[model samples]
Target: MSEVTVTVRGEHETRVAPERATIRLSVRAEGSERSPVVEHAMRLTEPVRDSITARKESGVIVDWTSTRLSVRAERPWNNEGKRLAPIYYASIDLTATFIDASDLSIWVSDVSPWDGVEVGSVSWHLTPETNARLEREVASEAVGVAVARARAYATALGLHDVEPVEIADAGLIAPTASAPPAGMAKFRGMVQESGDMTGASMAYEPDAIVITATVEARFVAR
Candidate 1:
């Protein structure tokens, strides 16, 4: 009899509370010339940057990185609907890491109200060491899931035994959008406003971060 093979996929998921918080902010300026816009953006961001720098002294801003500056010219479609005299725009983006979970609200409140500044959603994440450990654990569990399914298939087909012939791995799947925990909805929603807001009434609950692993195994009937 010819050999037969079946491919089965297994998935494993785990939830963990994030250990730290992250916030991204953008500083932008527009003008008729590149130099003027670049200067304006830098000046506008000074106050916000100063606040974070001050926090860094006390460990609130654990880590931060600045992205390269970008400048582009406005597309011209005549004066009626678009560009009048070729406006230029310059902007800088920065991301900050806050290790103290309790300081999330304070950090957001400090940065969101600056002029010409835009705030991104506050996201929570695990440390590098923690993430590595979780990944290993889930991967092993997923393989076990695959093995069980293969054995069940072998029994139904009346095959003597089943053995894995080929195994393919799938990488981790992360959430596309941040999911705010219950009671923190207002805190997250406050990001849309350009003014300082308070969320003292709400309690912070680290949203459970979901990690998923999938594996495909080809099993041969013996």
Candidate 2:
């Protein structure tokens, strides 16, 4: 007698609003000398950091880092077609991660006034607990779908017993956040109304994070 085997695949997807957010801010400064450019970039970090700390909402975390720093002179042609004195350029980046979305508006309003500092992306995501819970639920649903398909296959083959021989997690899909607003002008205006952060009610809303789970199951019939 020969044994019969069936392989089935199941997929499940779930969407949920994000519960956490990461906001990045950048500072760029340029000058004729390396010292001045670097100094200016470093000086710009104070106000932005101070502003976030001043927020009424608690649990707001701020992290500052230097993404890029370069001090090189670039020669340019003058009206006479002669190379002019070299110009030096320097740039720095700072990022802030906030647990509460409520502080986004105020942070933007306060930091927009700075000359070189600009608001970066605002990524939203579900917390670890919520993500884990969703993963488990979706995994179960996917396996159920696979089991049903396997049983149907066994019945069609005139098999009495159908047992799952192999099962595997196909790796869950990660969630993606919506792109940040186009510019700070509109975002600043949205929060300037009452000088209050637009907690979860900003004019722009992040897209719901989608999570997908898949499972592959192999069944054998006796």
Q: What would the TM-scores of all predictions be?
A: 0.66, 0.71
- Per-residue lDDT tens digits of candidate 1, residues 100-200? 76676666765566677877656777788887787777777777888898888777777767878886663222222332211111111112222333332
Candidate with the greatest lDDT versus the true structure: 1
With a 3 Å backbone cut-off (N, CA, C), the pairs that clash in candidate 2 are none
Each model's lDDT comes to 0.69, 0.63
TM-score, candidate number 1: 0.66
Q: What is the alpha-carbon lDDT for the whole of candidate 2?
A: 0.63
